[model samples]
Target: MKPRKQTRTISRIMVPTDFSPGSAEAFEYAIALAKRLKADLILAHVIEPFPYNLVEGMAFSDYGDRLTPPVQRLLDHQSKRAIKEKIPVKTRLIEGAPFREIIKMAKRERADLIVMGTHGRTGIDHLLAGSVAEKVVRLSPCPVLTVRSVPAASKPGSGKARSKSKGRKANVLKDKATLI
Candidate 1:
């Protein structure tokens, strides 16, 4: 009998979240994949620093009272949940532009892969607003997987199905794979 070869490629996955629905989907997907692959997961949230002018207006004590505890609580809660679910995870909160911070963390941690969500904006909307997922996919040292949410009622052959077909066609042009 021939021996089987294992083809699993990911050892660690970094998922950056803003606690949005899309990010939540990415988190869930990452956890499931990690469980199957027995890989470690890192959950990152980047808090962009307030503008200098804004920071200058606040008292140091006020800033501390208003910011640190809530942020820490959120990270602690998420980390505990991941551990309780039996998925090895490390939670981090950094200060910077989300895309740059995510990329920096990924490289620093030597993450094997990144799983993130795209808001799926286009044209003027996309141009006026840049996407963290798009930037990460373009600049990250390792491979990035982007996930988008599909509506619940869009059955095959329905009118909504046409939109999905168009999305798939666009994805081919954009080089995105819908893993879910």
Candidate 2:
């Protein structure tokens, strides 16, 4: 007897955003994919607490509370894009370690796939700060798709005319030590 082929259906997609440029790109990608797949989106934002002693006397809970509104606004704005595409979107505002929360949410929602942004950090920076996307990818229960932000210079129609002046300034800035 021949075995029947099993086709996987992606009914739910989870997108975790940090409101960064990379995340914006990922969100847009997720929106288009959701529309094409006819899948519902679960947009998640995790409000990571300030590192120990990073905020001096301010309590971690207080720091998270102050950031909640702005982060929520960002989530709402991204959701509008999905809604405009006629794709159903559910937003999750969570406070904890971002990677852990993202993993938990994906499993809790039974998401078939997770689409997120990668900052593409490397070497020293990546070693010290670690990477939420990397951690999530390692631990997630579902398939992970990571999107990296494209540099403006590489985009089509960027043009040599615009690059002449702005590009020189960018190069100079790139040579200097960046203050975090």
User: Which candidate should be chosen as best, given TM-score against the real structure?
Assistant: 2
Q: Tens digit of lDDT per residue, candidate 2, span 1-180? A: 999999879899898998887787677777767777899999999988867746778876689888888989988988988898899999999999999999999999999988888887889999999999889888989888887665666655646754553313212323221211
The candidate that wins on lDDT is 2
Pairs that clash in candidate 1: none
- Candidate 2 off by > 4 Å: 53-57, 159-180
In the order shown, what is each candidate's alpha-carbon RMSD?
7.2, 8.6
What are the TM-scores, per candidate, against the unseen true structure?
Answer: 0.73, 0.81
Question: Which residue pairs overlap in candidate 2's backbone?
Answer: none
lDDT of 1 by residue, 3-50 (tens): 999665888999888877667666666766677688898998887765
